[model samples]
Target: MDTCKNCGKPLENPDQELCPACRAVENAKARTRREEKAGHARRRRMNRTTRKMLIAVCVLAVVFTGLCVTATVMYDKYNPDEFIASVDAALEAGDARALKNLLKGEDLTVSDEGAAALCRAFTDAAQREALRGQLEDQVVDGGAQGAFPALGVEKESVFFGYSRYSLTVHSVRLLLSSPVQNLRLSLDGVPRTGEQTADGILYQNLFPGLYTCTVTGTTAAGQAVEGDATDLALLSSVEPTVFSGALPIADITVSGCVNDGAVITVDGAAVEQKPVNGVVTLPQVAVGSTIGMQYTAPWGAVTTASVQFADKTVTTLAFENPVTEGGVPAAGELNTLLTAHYAAYLDALNNQDTALISGCTEEYKAALAQGVVSDTHKANLYVMGTAECNPAAIKSTAADGTARVSCYVKLTYTHSDRESHEETPATAYRVYTFTWADGWKVSASADSTEEAYNTASMDALP
Candidate 1:
């Protein structure tokens, strides 16, 4: 028996190649292989069909794209005049969206509101007619060049006449010159509140009609100011309505022995003061404004003046002048003698000569004793050489025959401690008071404490 080249069971019949189960299994395997082969052939046929369909689609797409591009080019080239005519029609009719569509550029992105504003900016009918004529001229001259002549809606600002609708809704606005703080404004007997801007306050959205506008505010000094525009028609929104009026002010001029460029203050508020040829003039000063002046002279001589402001013409205020003594020695001769005395006084103080200042005021003598000898003694310091005094100016003698003069004194001396030595330079502004007692004598008193400056590096004495 031929053993089936399968399961090792003996063949039932000679012709039977394998056992029943093995024959059945082999037959099923062959059938399965044939079905798999048929499926592969069907898939291949379907793949060929799909590939042919894709090729057809791609070819159609290319043809369609080419046709579209050709159509666009032909339309732009031949029908550009027709397109421009349509745009002119749209602009003349104030059609924003239509105009936007006609104007083309990569940079253009006009919103509905922008287009409307652009159209309304041109209020003249003549401008619109002229613009249309210009467009027609371009189209005629272009002929074969295909020149659409850039509408430039994005680059240029085209203003056409306003539509009748915008004219109906236009409103009047009032602009104030100066913004009054905490302001109250009323229009047409109705309180219309508004906020302040940098230049002024703007009242917006007002109907174009007859109205009365009033603005009121309180000044910093508790004075009430009110201004009003009466029987105002406010017909046109084209022109700005500027409201400005006068405020109560006082004018004053300050002149005296004070130096130029003096600071002038009004009611404790610093006013911008400028001097022309050494005179300060306050052109506009508020009523009841407190006025004051301050400036520094050479040698640290500071003069100050203050006065109350009244509403009137330019009021002149004179500063209090310094007093000086007059005798047989003229003012110039007296100044010369005073200069010599001041020089001697400084020299004696440097040498610790108490006898030289015996005629000086008690206050000055005491200051010299304590500030000079006593202070230096405690610090183990000794000053050498005569001090230099340069007279700057001499004021006229007062009714009391008392005069005040300014001097710049540079005192250079060798400062010595018990251990080492150093050359010290000192500068001071000294104001001397002299009362004629026979000859010019150094009065013990000065107008103010003499300002002394010393650059000597020494330990702080008592």
Candidate 2:
């Protein structure tokens, strides 16, 4: 019997290698193997396609992430709100370096004190709100330019239609002045060289901000002095800002003085120090203060007129000795005698009597006598009243026993004629020459011009 070799099944036919069922089983097994190999090839092709698809997906994901990051960065850099927030942070922190980095300008700098002051100024709620509004308006509508004209907003384009915005600042002019000349100035610990002008010291291209100004100079007395002004705001570009301070002490030279006997008085207070070599170094006396000198003369003490203290200038306090070698009367005695002489002269004219003219010299008496006689011949009786003389009108006194005096006479007189008698009032300015003959006597009298009267009146002393 032929047995099936594969499965040991019985064979019906002879000379068969295997049973029929066994052969069928082998054929089915072979078909199954071919199908499995084809399936495996299909699976390998599918896996390669899947791997390529995965790689493309990963590449797309990475690209999408990069684009997202770039978009976010552009948005933050160009966003007005974000820009403003950065500035607000810097100001709140009072970080001068950060603020300077955020600003865009040529040759711009910020000092720590200046930045701190700026931060303080913006710390107010209302001011911060106003600033925010102004910055926003400047960025959006281009309005509010005048609010901070020196400051502005600039924009630049980046990738993918994005923009970067920055704040631009410009410099302004600062003008400083002081009564102290030759002043060396510094701002924010930095030495500043300035141009001298008629108005003041001009500093150009200075940043607009608060500054600590320091001034140093030598006074008129050759003493070093220093002064400082804090929080000096110079935030305008349209007009120059000015700062003036009084810091210099002035020395006054009292020339024409005989010795150091003159006492210096400033603003009515006598100084303890006296003049040395006619030079008075008034360290405590400020410029523009009133200063005067008082000296004791041979006859009396005299005070010079008060003058405004100027830097390194000479003021003459010349005291002319009123008393000379001759027996000239003192100024006070001469003034009194001249006043009385004018009174007697008016009385003599009114009474038509030469006896009352005893104060006049013999030559003047003869002249007055002739005038009285001439008036009597004309039938004009001149009756005079009230005469006054100003003692300050003494022009000068000479060692030759002669003195010039100006008299202002107010007279009320009755001019009686045969036709009519009239009471008349008259004012006269007369210059008289008085000679010391035994005593003070009026030697000559003449009507004075108005100009001469004014000059003599102005020359009079108090």
Candidate 3:
């Protein structure tokens, strides 16, 4: 057995060092473990740094996507014209609340567009001042009332700032109202002019795709209002409809005597009096507004009416209740009863029989008596021969109860046939009347032979 030369030790098997060699081996192994532990710590630190970098990159990507979404939403809501339109609608409606809401917390000076808006909303000084307190940034009192609040617009507002707004730029140019009044506007984050005009506003430089536009303007006396159109393609054509004139009124209900008279007024203008059939026609009207009317009957009695007219339409009028003289039914029903009675009377006169003319009223008999010759009035004998009567056309008086219906007629007589056939023509006018019990009667007769007829008057006759 061999042993370490430096150490005296009991050898086991042939070669051996000392009994403490096992402890030495253990000490060397511990030293190697410490070196490996140091190397492993270095690797773990490097790995943690790589992980932190990857996490930071992911977070940044998410933030960027969110920002993009928010920007897109905000862009969709942008419109250049809405800054001024909120005032117009409120003014037309005369709404106090809307006028007040538009002025709330806004930092602005009175502008030309704002002045016009106020003028359009209120026509009078008192009304305009009240509206200003509600929505105006400042109230300018022109005590003289000589158009002191006139709008002042600069020449620059007529054209866009760009050479020509291309259809592909979506960014907006909020043109300030000319004279920079109460409205605030921005064009690409810069301030410009402020003004309102009839030519309207144009927004260009939009992406070549579908888009929505909203225009809002408010008067100092108007409330905040909004308007928007959706799904409007950027390159698409746009058209709007327009109408003019005062609104129409509803059809009126009228009823009264036709010949008696009535009046028709449209838009407060008196047009006609005593219209036939109680009919009045108004000119066609536009949709969406109230119309006023007045009516006068015969005798100058008047009444009033109104209606909400539809767009592009006409109003018709009808009589409510019609009254006539003699307590007769309507003219239509009177025609029927009168027709039958007159037909029977004509037949009886042709037959020349006493029984045939029996239905004639006592008044008609008296009227006939007045026509008899004065000297032959009491003679029972046939002094004149055959009596002849021909009916004539009917006429009505001025529609008052004093005047009823009168007829023109002719009568002749043959005292004797001197030479063969002989005929005489007589012309006269007779008045017809009616009573509850008498049914129909003759009131008076005035013949064309007035001179001779007057000589035969009842007071003059024997």
Query: Which of the numbered candidates is closest to the native, going by highest lDDT?
Result: 2
Across 293-384, the per-residue lDDT of candidate 3 in tens digits comes to: 44333323244444544433344434434333333223343344344434444334433333433233566544443334334322222222
- lDDT string for model 1 (347-406, tens) is 565666656655455556666665545545443443434433333333323222233333
Rank order (by TM-score, best first): 2, 1, 3
Identify the candidate with maximal TM-score: 2
When sorted by lDDT, best at the front, the candidate numbers are 2, 1, 3
Clashes of each: 9, 0, 38
Candidates in order have lDDT scores of 0.51, 0.63, 0.36
lDDT over C-alpha atoms for residue 270 of model 1: 67
Output the worst ten-in-a-row residue range by lDDT, candidate 2.
316-325
Q: List the residue pairs that clash in candidate 2.
A: none
